[model samples]
Target: MRKAPLASLATVGVIATEDVHSNTSVQQALASSRSLRSVTAPALITPRSDGRARATRTANFVSGQTAFAPTGVRLAFSYARQSEEFPDGIRRQHEENARVAAGLGFAIPDTPEFRYSDDETSGRLKSRDAFNRMLDRIASESKPASALFIRERSRIGRWNDPRRHDYYAVYFADRGVPIVESCDPQWVDWDNDTSDEVTLRFLHSTLKSIQSRNERIEIVKRTNRGTRAHIKQGFYSLKAPYYATDRWVAWAHTREPILKLDPGVSYVREGCAIILRWATDGSVQVVRDIFGWILGGRSLGWIAAELTRKCVPPPGARYNTARVDGPWHKELVRKIARNPIYRGDLLYGRTSQRFRGQEAVLAPQAQNDAFGKILYLDFLSDPPLSRGDFEAVQERLEANLYQHEARSRTKRNYPLSGVLVCASCRRGLHGFGSAPNRVGQVRTYYRHSMTRGEGSQCPHENRYIAAAPVDSALVNIVHDALASDRLQQLVASEVTRYLDDPRQRRRAEERHACASEIRELERELGRLSEELGQCTQSHWERSLRSRKDRIVSKLEALEAVGATLAQEDARLAAIERGLAHQEAYSATLYTLYGQAPTLVQRRVHEGLIEAVHVDFASRQVLFTTRSSTLGAEACGD
Candidate 1:
């Protein structure tokens, strides 16, 4: 074996807060002291965001460029945040941010390969993303100086609960990347540094961490107090409005609605209006007629389809579907019959225990409302609607909601599928499979894939339908949806709107830059490849061969970079189109077509339709859309 000389050097990695904390006493101290500038600190590579009174931290900090130690050793960056709230979203954001940050560093002169990671844990010096990547980068090199950086101690890690102010400064100090906090140049003595000095640094970090946490507690207290007051003032505490359908919370400042209400509300409102219009003498009769049509012999889906075919408008007079319809589906029926809000009541709470590795679970409305129901049972009961009557009515309403439904659609896709259910059983209608095994010469039949388990108390499985027919049905539906002239106009309108967004414009610009870089990388790779081909190492050939090998390796890596950039550019383009055509397409599908298109159509239509609820028996699809104008034009009962 021949000895090899090390030629590659690792760069510095800065893990800082997203924003700078200008108001912090520490910050004030740094700003006021003239001597601070003489410290020969690492140049500010990525400035932090304003502390926002509590020093905000992002799971993945945004990337920026600046000078560092050794007068530009170059920098690589990554960030970490716990998955206690939104795991997947946080992870995705972290990974995306890391990639961007790494790319930014690569663009800097004399930069080394930058790596990224996002891990979930709170122990000091124990992050998988930070610690592991730090080890990987250092191991790849043979020097003690190549290392990682962090905004502050707490940002990287924390001590035990008892020693809440403590941190692991030595652990990272020993492995290089000796924890750079806020633009400070690498501490030469930090490696052989005394315990007392390190302890003092840790103490300062501890105080900062405590202050940040306290600030967060205060912010939450303030927010909750305001929310309680708002609740008392006849406004909802949660910002999501009954039908807003998009934002996590709607701000009073903007006065824009964004919350999506339960489809039950829409169904009841539509049904109520129709009942109100009928003669009081035959009002119950009308209900009976609907119930019989849905529960007795026909599937709720069939009845919903029939009503839609008869020109019935959905709740709020949006999207009348009687004239244009699909086949009846059980989900629409249950939504109408089992809705308590129609009776002027509210329900909330239930939670699913399912998981996707690190993904967090959102509590179901039924679970959250369980306690509220127990507390208000008597208070909410009407003279004729006793507690027992309420229970009975609930059962009857549910029964009325789902009279008949095909069972096979309930399996395959569970949690998500059940979310869209028939009102009676409140179980999602199983999708009928259509894809064929033409290559295998095998016949396919519909089969039940899920069940309600022992608690017929909730929803359950249904009978299967054949694959061939359902596949044909799907094709027809999609064809009809695509052919609708109104849908095309909607798409065009949305595309125009997408072109107007500032954020979209910024992303588009970035994507264009990435595309250009990819092209440049490809050209560079080709040149390198050609150079390697012409090289000879011995007889000038031997030395040339060695150089050529190195060049080829470099070229291959450059090609990889080009490939990544291309993928990123594609993702950005998809996002741009989605944001651009979001509204018009949704309105067109929901209003004119009377249903939100499937995931397939969504890709074709972009992020237009807000949601869709299918009726199995009636074949009338209920659509929830984002456009106010188109929604207003929809037919309500």
Candidate 2:
């Protein structure tokens, strides 16, 4: 290649010299040939055909290069919490980021790919579309960015935890890309290993994070104070009132009505308060009908179905027209029946707002006379239900709850009801009992839950299995395990391990706390009952009675919880004692198994078996015990 290119150059030079000694026409020809050579000489010695020559040339060119230096690439991210703050907030931050990048001698790509903005999104949240996309790009890109620009460190996040806010900075810094706050005067030099500079940068970041956290906390405190004040002034602070109730804006001090707000209208002037009133529409009649039906012994599901059948609009239909045709649910009926607003009373603070990680949640708070915060307002000329009727409704609801619990307890009668699962679809097998035949023998069978449903999804052809054999197999397994010494040791170790578990300790602590609350509530209830007996005024008597009733309700709930915990502890103790004296315990268990009711047998199965997966095709039954360490064993039917 070298010889060929050298020979071509020599030939061109010889032609040019010969032409110089010729006539004018020859000189003109030589000039034209020289122009051609100037155009094609570089192409003739091209490096495209040889890799080695190209590398050598590149090294030489780089060695001699001196004019230009490469600049760092800058990426920008902007975020705003509200839609109204966007465009202005996002645009200003981006422009400031570009100016800062230019000042730092960094090149910001003009394309939108390098700029990320999460408009109308909270920085305190963990998931944001644009923010996550930017992070993904940085992680997956072949060439990493030298710097990431934001209006301030808080633009990255205002996390509740200060350490969470610092995580982004540390993450970028560790990846060799330092986050640069455009608003900050002192930029961190992440590449430098100077201890003092690093310490200063770390201190600055920590201070900013703490400042952001303090500001957020202050905002939350101010909001909570305002909300409490608003509630105390007898203004509705929660979501729109229940169905048939209308919200009217009134002067805070005078209680003078300003206007009746339309559905979904939430705006209220600074000096105005929101008052709940009964609507003049037919919905008030519907509310009365619902309460009457509940008092008339109609079930909630039955009422919901009747309302849906009659094409009556459900709750929230006024706010959202789409819900006009939506079917009424039992839960909607339940809320209406349970709400005190129907009886011309306003109740607030039944639940408190809390934050779980980045998400805001509302947790139910225990209700007492002090924290329950009941306000009596004349919302309707004639309320839907009288106070006596409301109390009756509450009693009926409590009865319904107890009935529901009883029904649930007796719902599954077979010993293997919950334990048996279909291997094909992994669905629990539901138990069905056939009518007694001439011999007065009732046959029970287990069937897949989805096998006979309208839109059945289980593909297994053989879906039904006799429950008697499955129950017998489970009972035999339990008996065999009780007799085996190895199983006894395993059960002892498992029981000991479970008793020492942190979760069990937490449960015990919760039970203790629950019992303490129960005692406090009982004292409160006695005080209220005394007040009720002494009260001369009818209104005061009614209030005291209501308070007493609420305390009683709370006591019942807590007592129920304590009883459950006690039962669990007793069961564990019995198991431990039984394991210590196996002979008597085995005999007792055998006698109980032979004579126990279906409900007791079901409970015994639940205590011992984790799951029983049945495969019809392979004709195998897999029994998984409660002790996970023992693993599973297969047995033929």
Candidate 3:
């Protein structure tokens, strides 16, 4: 409805219902009307429920006078587009930024007419509304306000971001606005004969202002650290933000605060992510199949495709905080294969995420930055993958890497290549041509160097040998040797040289150091225990107990490592002692040879087998072992 203008209503009497629903609004309107009427008595108007409805709605004959409003007549009414503009008439300023952040200064100087207080705001930027209002009022030409007093720089703006607060004093002072800053005791006390007036006046405040900011920062860091420590005990550090409901979600119509995010900690409820009963379940089969497929030479894409086809939900689909169902991607397969959580292993400090300026980014974790660094750990759920199996899968994954020399490498693929030696020249034979096949569709031969080049036909006797026959002979020889006590003797004789090897010596020294450290820790723990016994107060004793718990955790880890090393050292010492018996030594060799890699096979052959010769005409093979000087054994086919 179009209502008469407030100015026009002053002249015309109108009846309007009083807006009784809002007493404050009606009171304000009435007060404004009174204010306007005091300037010029145009008409008698009573406020209605709507403004209580239009002011001029009521028309009355009073003393038979016709009233016409003048332009100068004031109205106590406000409008949507235009409103009264006046300051509350106070000229006080507050260094409220530091006051909130550091609680450095609460009392403002006694000089200002009024103060602007920015309670509980961050000092990262000039984000205080009160600060802005103060400036606007100070800048207005009507008041032409000139001076402001601050307890200190930190109380006004962050010292780290000098640009935020430095300009107020400088910019305003140049234009006759000059902000007056009252120094705290430190600033007032800091004066010397050599100092200039400006330097002396500002030095203490400047120094203490920065100190206050630093104090605030340290407090925040300690608090964050405490929260992170709390996270270790199966509680969340960050609050349940409204937008981050996925990260910290409560189930529909539930009392749970959020998801059980602590790794290893289990909470089974009707909620996604938070319901953490991830033991031997469907996830086990899925994870096992994923890893098995990867190990079985299936590509990531193939794994993903097959899993999806089988109606398997990917890791994140069911367990992710958001509980959003989706199709599997190759990356999901890769990460699942790589995640150490399934293997019951914990790793930290690989990467960290934080806000840098306005953007959230992932960067390499801290390089010894004590304050900013954080560690994350995972606790094993149940039925974790065996360490050996996990390591073997990782080995296979690493070996699958395609590199410049990967294809050329034959040690792993062909175990006996570097092990076999040419009987005629006593030189290492190179396997060439087509790969060795017993069916003979393609021929592969271990040929000596003289047989390859276009040289004068000066031949070494039996320079070329069929690779399949040699390989077949080699496998049979290994099996036969391992079946007897001779292999054990060979292994012990070989390992005896390694007893004093540098690497072994270093490991022994490390074990010794570990033992020493454990002793020292034990002694320190005893001292702490003694101190703890003397502690009486509940809080003090609690703190001591926490310290002891942390020390105990560290001690337990050290003990585990120490025990493992001791077992290893004892085993190696027994192997050294058993080298005296040929049968025992051979048994040791047999165990080692069974577990050894292809490169170790080469070493084994080089140390024990000396040479292998095959005569196709005689259909016989001669083998010489380093067992003894009279160690030649020949087999005829």
lDDT of 2 by residue, 1-637 (tens): 1111112221111111111211222212112233222211111111333332211010001111111124423333333233223348777777788776565444566556667777766566788888887777666544334457787777777778999866777676455445767775233333332445457767878998999888777766665666655655566655466688778888988978889887655664788888777787788898888889989988787687678777788876887888887788888898888877788765554333432123211222322222224343543457878989999999999987865565454444577776788888888887776544566466678876642212345676336888878877887777865555665576677878887789988988998999899989988888887877788999888888888888888899899999999998898788767666767755766787768898777776676677789897886677877763334564648
Top lDDT prediction, candidate number: 2
Which model, 1 or 3, shows the larger lDDT?
3
Task: Report lDDT (CA) for all predictions.
Answer: 0.39, 0.63, 0.49
TM-score, candidate 3, is 0.26
Least accurate 10 contiguous residues by lDDT in model 3: 75-84
What candidate 2 gets wrong by more than 4 Å, as runs, is 1-75, 82-150, 153-160, 171-180, 185-192, 238-249, 257-270, 278-286, 301-329, 353-383, 406-411, 414-637
Please write out the lDDT profile of model 3 over residues 70-153, one tens digit for every residue. Answer: 432111100010011213212212333223212211122322223455544555445566666666655555332223445445
lDDT (tens digit, per residue) of candidate 1 on 1-637: 1111111111122222223345543221111123221111222333345424322111111112222445443343434444234447444544544444333331112223333334444433344655566556555434323334444444454433424333344444444434444324223233233445446755665676776566545544565555434332323433222211211223344434344333222211211111111112222333445545543455555565555555433333322344233333346555544533223233221122232133222222223212222111121122222344344545665554342132233333221232234434545554443323345243444333333212343222454434454434433444445445556666666756765668767765665775676566566657656765786654655655666566567657656665665686587577566655555554554454334345444343223334444444553334444452233112111
lDDT of 3: 0.49
Estimated TM-score for each candidate: 0.29, 0.45, 0.26
